[model samples]
Target: MIKPFSVIATRLVERTIRINQAARTFYACEKGSIFINFGVIVVPLIAVVGLGVDVGRGYVVKARLSQALDASALAAAPYADNVVKLQAEFTKYFDANFPSSFMGVDITLAPPVISDNGTKVTVSASAILDTTLMSVLGEDTMSVSASSEVTRLITPLDVVVSIDTTGSMGSSDGSGTRLSSAKDAADILVNKLFGNETESDNLQVGLVPWSAAVNVAERGVSYDSGLNTFVDGHWYTNNSPVPFITEPDSDWQGCAYARYTDNSNDDDADHLLYDADVGGTIWEAWEPMPRRVVNPSNGNLYTVRCPEWGISKLSGTKSHATDAIEELSNPTGTTTIAQGLVWAWRTLMPGEPYNQASIKSNLRRAIVIMTDGLNTSSYRDAYKGDLNVSEMNDRLSAVAAQIKATGVDIYVVEYHVETNLMKSVASATTAPYYFKADSAAELEKAFEKIGTELSELRLSK
Candidate 1:
């Protein structure tokens, strides 16, 4: 009855249950071991990630410090006349931004480093920044250095502002129209060159208004005695045989000359004569006035005395230049860069006779040339016909090169020039400062940039 088969079956079932329990215990032990092993690897990875975050923050601080330092260095350099002041400004700028970094900074300034006849200065600033993360990798500090050279800009600035008063200037670019925008920029530049207050006698500016030919401003008339007599509200010469300006009650109440250039084809050139006299006195008739010697090369000269009158002073009085601009209502002339460059040279060099060596040497010589179009005219060729714009550009490049060689800094501003030709002219400068203003907004910014660069920094004064 208690069969042997039944007992054997029961024994087999007990053995199977014991084997399954042993396997489960072994599996649990292995799983715990694997978890511990994996945690060891993950701990170091998290620490490294945390370190990277701190490193990025440090980099941002360093970048900001670099920018602030550059600006401070330029400002401080002018004040740093000697090594002592140089060190002081360096410390001031450095400490203001990176207080801890520049604590023990090493500054080295070489002699003759001071500019503006030693009233302003220049020096190299260097510092070591301690690394927070890299230190653990055996590198502790990173060395950084910045060099600065600053000279007082307060010296004489022979600024020849070549403005495009062509027909296009009347079009809206930005800050009103091109002409208005240019005047705005010009006013700022003038203030900077000749300090806003009492501009020194050393600084002189020649404003060249160019459409087809450069119009010599009233300011520059004295240099060319011929041009002065022609523009000073006179028909023929001031001392003409007919006597335009006689004693008191002369029959001719001093005729106002024709405002339009005689060569213009407009019928109004003959019909309407602008009253040149301040009191509106009209000249009797328009005779074929002799050509005043505009070009000495052409063998013509004006014998009359050109009056010395300023259109505007430091006090901002009535501006004849402004009036001249207003008079140009229908400005339809094309641009000729060659003539503009030539005029700029004339203002600076004044040729052999009027070249003042003292002014050239002591003062800062500079030319700010800006144009929206490529050269379309040449002195050798007439501008009216279908001009080979490229050929005229070549002539312009040559003229620019000639002027740059005379030791004056040329700042070339291209409003919308193509790549190839713009750089060619810009490259001729000793210190090439080039800009491309494509839009009206950009043009305004371009002018602001020029004004900022042209500012003066007086040291001794």
Candidate 2:
């Protein structure tokens, strides 16, 4: 009994000592637990925030750099005549748009790569951004890069000017007549085109002066009519075969009247081949009756021919065009703008009689049609049936549509006229192409603007 009691007491004492040691271990283990929690959780949280800030800063750098690079590429495209010039332009533009350094940030730009055709340019810019919080992670800075590409705007321009030269063009405004003002403006336009370069393979110009009628059938220009017989100078009159002419030509003039659809369907929307034709001896052909000699006793008419309409064929030289204008005689007869438009369209078309220079692929053709008066269908008019002003406008509109359909840009300028009718004429084409000149000086300015507008810049990429 005594031995069992002593053993129990010793075991109880050991149990108490073991319980005290466990309590002391619990207090010691929890002593610095708050600091451990802070080190483990708060440190990583701060690092993550710092990384986020640094990464956000990298995005900012890239966005700004990208904007600058894009601007630089675009500004440099036009001046990219050579690598040195393009690089200089890019640097100038980039420096102006974005900072080379921001708060110790350094930027580097690569020499832009210009495509073989010089139409496209690609550039890349990079920047090194110093970090704030991320430095704690042994990363002192971050890198960002931006790239951009740009394309040039204009294609080569082949332009034609079909101007009215009726007696009405000689009618005066406050200063000069319409014809005179047009001549001055055209001369200035030519100067702008050729500049100092006497020779350019890219630009070609044609001039058509129309009055009373155009000299297509009578003048016998090569046309799609499949009628090459005009070279023989034997032409029908008033729908009669040449043999039907009993009297000699009293006044045989080479003036193209409207063809079947051209005259009957004056507002021809299809703008088929008929609209381009000047017609033949068939009722479709619109030519003035052959001149007849008055037997004096019988008062018979004779076929006395007048000179054909004058056209300056397509040429690349300013001198050629200006000289042709100089050769033009004083205006006479009625206004037939449609004929002038058709002939001008023909001048730009590739193939025989014209385009001795050969039609280059991808040629950009354009037309500038100027008229001082409205179209008519009197004896002065070329159509078989008389057409009122509205009908005349419809015909003009149809012809304009046809020309544009051929991928030829058309610009219409009405001189001293402010009618929507004229504005409608201008509206048939792209915007900024329609011009209403109230004065001679304004006319000149319009021509200048046309020249500038034709040589414009557009964003390609």
Task: Name the candidate that leads on TM-score.
Answer: 2
For all the candidates, what are their Cα RMSDs to the real structure? 21.2, 16.8
- Model 2: lDDT equals 0.62
**What TM-score, computed on C-alpha atoms, does each candidate reach?**
0.47, 0.54
**Residue-pair clash count for candidate 1:** 3
Tally clashing residue pairs in candidate 2: 24
lDDT of 1 by residue, 132-218 (tens): 543443444444444445555555556666776666667776547766666665655554343323434555655556655543223
- Writing each residue's lDDT as its tens digit, candidate 2 over 142-232 gives 6677788876443566788888887777777657667778888887677655544465577777787786456543122322222323423
- Which runs in model 2 stand beyond 4 Å of their true positions? 1-154, 216-254, 260-309, 352-358, 427-431, 457-461
Give the Cα-based TM-score of candidate 2 against the true structure: 0.54
Q: How many Å off is the CA of 336 in candidate 1? A: 1.0
Q: Which ten residues in a row have the lowest lDDT in candidate 2?
A: 239-248
